[model samples]
Target chain A: NAGVTQTPKFRILKIGQSMTLQCTQDMNHNYMYWYRQDPGMGLKLIYYSVGAGITDKGEVPNGYNVSRSTTEDFPLRLELAAPSQTSVYFCASSDITWRTEAFFGQGTRLTVV
Target chain B: EDQVTQSPEALRLQEGESSSLNCSYTVSGLRGLFWYRQDPGKGPEFLFTLYSAGEEKEKERLKATLTKKESFLHITAPKPEDSATYLCAVQVESGGNQFYFGTGTSLTVIP
Candidate 1:
C-alpha cells in the first residue's frame, strides 16, 4: 500500500505564481500534516488537519493555505508565491494513537524563482 | 514555544566507531519523542519512539534513550550505510497533534 503520496515531486514557479501541492494517503490516517524544510533548517510546520474538514495553522503558515475535504486528501495551496517560499515540502500522516510514528511521503521540491 | 534542538550539526566517524547523537527539547507537555533517519533527497524515515523519561528502544545497531529534557540516539559500531541525517521530533500534548522537529545531525561514517 502506498502509505502517503505527494504529487509534483519537483516544480519551479515564477514569483507571484500560484500552485497547489497535492497529498493523499491510503492508510486512512486521522492526522495529516504539511511541513517545509529549508536549507540547513529544521522542518517547519505549515498546517495540519486532525480530520476531514478541520484544519489549523502551524508555526509557518503566513504564505500557505490548506484544506482537508476528504480523509485521503489534504492539499496545500500557495498563492502569490515568493522566492522565499522555495523549499522541500513534505506530507505526513499518522494514526490517532499518539504512539504511532508519522509516515512521510517522498516530498515535493518547489523552487520559486 | 515548543522546540527541538539537535547537537553537533555534523559528525564524521570511522567504520565500527560508536557514537551518540543528542536531541534536546522543550515542550509544554510531552506526548512522545521520535527518531528518524533521512537520506539525501528523501523524506525522513521513522526509527524509534520514546514515550517517557528512562525509556529506551533499539533496532539493529541503533538504540534510543529518552530523559525529561533530552534524548540520545546511540549508534554501535556504525557502518557506512548508517551515514545520513538523523532527525528528532517531539509531539506535545498541548500542541494539538503538531510535531516539532530538530534541525538534524548529518552523520558520515567513513568506510
Candidate 2:
C-alpha cells in the first residue's frame, strides 16, 4: 500500500550544502514526524506536523526545517549540512486518534563530509 | 521531562531460547507505550502498543506486557529470523503527541 515513502535512500553532501528529504504517506494520516537516528542513540525527533500548514520544532530541530504543505507530504530541509548531520533519517505518520501506532518510511541515509 | 530506558544494550541467544527485553519509562502522564522492531538499514517497524497497566498483547512468538513503571517484550522459542533491534517509545499526555524513545536493545538469535 506504500504506507510511507521517503526519497533519496542514500546521499552524500559536502559541508554547507543543502538538501531536502521528501516524505509522503498514502495512508492519509494527519500526524507526520521527522526523526534522525544515530548509532547507539534513540530516534530523536527533528520536526513534526499535526496537519497541513501546521509544523512544530521537535527535540533536535536545529539545522533542520520542515514543511507540511499537504496532508500527504512533509518534507525536511537541511539548510547548511554539517558533518554532525550525518545520520539515518526516518519519516513517520500516524492517525489522529490516540494510541494508534506510527508507520515509518524505509529511511534516508545522509552523510555530510 | 519524559524519559525511556531499555536494558541490555545487546543480547545473544540460541534458537528456541526464550528471553525478555526491558523498557522502563518515566512520564508525567503516559498516553501509550509502543514497541518497534528495526532491522539494519531499515526504519522501525511497529510491533505492539500498550495503553494501560497490566495489559498484554501477543503476536506469534512475541508477547508484550505493560505495567505502571515498565514493559517487557518476551520472545518465546525464538528463531534466527527474530533477531533485530527492539525499540521502546512512550507518548506523553501533552505536547501534541510527541514520543520519547529509548536507545533500544539489539538481539541476536543464533541458529
Candidate 3:
C-alpha cells in the first residue's frame, strides 16, 4: 500500500502567491501532521490533525493553514508565500496508539522568489 | 514549553568505530521518544521508539536507550552505509500527537 503520498513534488512560487499541498494516506491513520524543514535545520511542526474536522497549530503556523475534511486527506495551504517560507514540506501519518511508527511522504520542495 | 535538543551537530567516525548520539527534551509528561535516520533529500525513516525511562531497544547495529529527560542512540561498529543524519524526536502526553524534533546529528562513517 502507498503509505503516505504528497502531490506537486516541487514548486516555485512568487511573492504573495498561494498554493495548496495535498497529502493523502491509505493506512487509515488517525494522526496526520505537516512539517517544514529549512536548509540544515530540523523539522518544525506547522499543523496537525487528530482526525477528520479537527485541526490544530503546532510551533510554526504563521503563514500556513490546514484542513482535514476526510480521514485520507490532509492538505496544507500557503498564504502570501514569502522567501522565508521556502523549505521542504513533509506530510506524515501514524496510528492513534502512542509511540507508533510514523509514515512520511516524499516531501514537496517549495522555493519562493 | 516543550522542546528537543540534540548534541554534536555533526559527527565523523571510522568504519569500525562506535559512538553515541544524544537527544534531550523538556516536556511536562513525555509519552514516548522516537529515533529516525534521514538520508540527504529523503524523509526521515523510523528507527526505534522508547516508552519509559531505563528502557532500551536495539536493531542491527543500533541501540537506543531512554531516560526521564534524555535518550541515546549508540551505534556499534558502524559502516559507511550508516552515514546519514540521525534525528531524535519526542511526543508528549498532552492530548495530542505533535512531535518536537531536534536539529539532528549528521553522522559520517568513513571507510
Model 3 collision count: 0
User: Candidate 1, DockQ to 2 decimals?
Assistant: 0.82
Ranking of predictions according to TM-score? 2, 1, 3
The true-versus-predicted C-alpha distance at residue B89 of model 3, in Å, is: 0.6
- Candidate 3 lDDT over residue span A1-113, tens digit each: 78999999999999999999999999999999999998668999999999999999888999999999999999999989999999999999999988787888989999999
Question: Residues B1-111, candidate 2, lDDT per residue (tens digit)?
Answer: 778999999999999999999999989999999999999999999999999999999999999999999999999999999999999999888756777789999999999
Interface C-alpha RMSD after superposing true interface residues, each candidate, one decimal: 0.9, 0.7, 1.0
Per-candidate TM vs. native? 0.98, 0.99, 0.97
lDDT by residue (A9-76, candidate 2, tens digit) is: 99999999999999999999999999999999989999999999999999999999898889999999
Report candidate 3's interface RMSD in Å: 1.0
Candidate 3: where is the Cα deviation over 4 Å?
A: none
Estimate every model's Cα lDDT from 0 to 1.
0.94, 0.95, 0.93
Q: Report the lDDT of model 2 for residue A54.
A: 97
Write one digit per residue (lDDT tens) for candidate 3, span B7-99: 889999999899999999998888789999999888899999999999999999999999988999999999999999999999888767778
